[model samples]
Target: MFENATKQLRETVEAALPELNTVVGWRAGYDPLHMTPVFIKNAGDLSKLEWSPFCVQNLSGYLVKDPAVRAQDPSKKIGICVKGCDSRSLVALIQEKFIERNQIHVFGIPCRGTVDWRRVMKLGPLTGIQSARVEESRLVVEDANGGHTFALEDVLARKCLRCAHPNPVIHDVLIGEPVTPRVAVENSYGEVERMEEQSLEDRLGFWKKELDKCLRCYACRNACPLCVCQDRCIAETREPRWLTQRVGTSEKFLFHFIHALHLAGRCTECGECERACPMEIPVTLIKEKLNKITLELMSYEAGMDPEAVPPLLTFNPGETGL
Candidate 1:
């Protein structure tokens, strides 16, 4: 599947290179087992592109950063590869007027699931595994001792299991044949629902317990492709001091609240924030609850279409659905 996808992706980029300034996709990292975002300027570099479960990072964030290409030649388009959630971010960006639709050439991939490296590490202590590969929906782990097989579903990130739109929501060219959408289950926000049922004090205590483990790494914010506002982040400011830099329960609570509030209507629920956290915080739960509120109160879903405006962006006096 990856081979065919890679071939088609390379061909697409090669054909579009004359009109595009850059083609962004996943390239193998210094460690062959991992993948990193690769920006290809020339057609010849397309051969370096690859895709797999390890290609989990959202590339949409880079679109807003291509100032050099845009400034030098605003008409020249940029090519990008996107999974389901990443496509939504593209749509959201377009809706928010962050980027023009014509400025991007999107190649969409139907993602089955992505691996959680931390979860994989938990299977056993580091055993010198040189590389890992996916074959027939099973992970093939290779090390000095040989290969072992583990069911892909068992080790896949939890977000993937609950994912509804595995196929890109928007795309100019789709690489692989689409698969059947899994049965829509209510489990996606189950954890958040359980938390909601707890008393206010209990819920606060629950979050306090989790936030206590935080080292204030800001990995969640950094990993988020939607968190484009880096210059004036509330965490770093001091004039007004919206949040203290000191690592404590008060500061952590403030951080989480501001983070969730900022992502109220814009979050695509990509689960990158949770995946990137070294402490394994359930960051998506907060985003999921916000999503539920957005749906219930405003009847809106983020990143479904480039033309669809977010409810929070507009005021409707008659809107009282909740």
Candidate 2:
């Protein structure tokens, strides 16, 4: 299914090239289990683009972070491909006017789910992967040794398990047939639901232990699609001195606090932050709790309506539960 979708994706992008200045997509990374972002300007580079469960990075952040992409002439339109969750980030960017709808083309793909490399490792001493493909009920892997198969449940990302939006919300050109969402809109908060039942101290201890493992690498912040504050970030600002160069549990906790608060009513829950963490911290849980708060207090879901303002971005005097 992915191979067919990949073929059609390349064809569609090639057909739309005349309308776009540059197209951003994923290419095979250094290893078989990886997929890295690439920019395509001509048809010759289309081979660099690939679609698979390993294509996990949310590419929308590139529009703001890549100087060359942003520096293009106003008349030249950019193109980007988005998975279901990634489209929400794009929608948030559009709602914030960080990027105009007319300035770019969107190729939306209905993601079944992305694979977690760590989960795959737990299956066995797996390495030297030459290729991988998803079968009807299992993932087939080819390596220097031989072919192996594993249940999809053993390797799927936790975010994909609870994904409420598997089909892209917005797309100028959709690459494949729309897929049914794995998660229902009403039951999207299951992960955090159990955590919420814990006592206050237990909740505090959970984060403290997690933050203690943080290397202060800022990988989580860097990977976030909506974290547009590149240089002016409070984490490194000098004049304000929001955070010192020190690395400690207190600093880590505070840093996460800032990160999660800034993303309130804005994060698309793409799971990039957690994936980027070298320490394997469940950082998205912080954002999940924040999302639940917004849902319960304001009845708002981020990135659902591009024209509707984020709840926190707008003031409502009648809103209670303050």
Best by TM-score: 2
- TM-score each candidate: 0.94, 0.97
Q: In model 1, what are the clashing residue pairs, if there are any? A: none
Give candidate 1's TM-score. Answer: 0.94
- Badly placed stretches (over 4 Å) of model 2 are 320-322
lDDT at residue 130 of model 1 (Cα atoms): 81
Across residues 1-322, which tens digit of lDDT does each residue of candidate 2 receive? Answer: 6889889999999999877889999999987778999999999999888988889999999998889999986787999999999999999999999999889899999988999988887885666888888876588888878998989888888899899898889999898888888777568888799998999999999999999999988899999989999878888888978777777789899999999999998988999999999999999989998998888888788998889899888888887877
**Tens digits of lDDT, candidate 1, 1-322:** 5677778878887888899878889998765356899988987788899878888888888887556545646678888999987899899889888889988999899888888877776774547778888887898788777776778887788788778778899999888878655535344666778889999999889889998888888888877777877667888777888876677888888897789888898898888889889899888888889987887678778888788888888877887885
Number of backbone collisions per candidate, in order? 0, 0
RMSD vs true structure, all candidates: 1.8, 1.2
Q: The CA-based lDDT of model 2 is what?
A: 0.89
lDDT of each: 0.82, 0.89
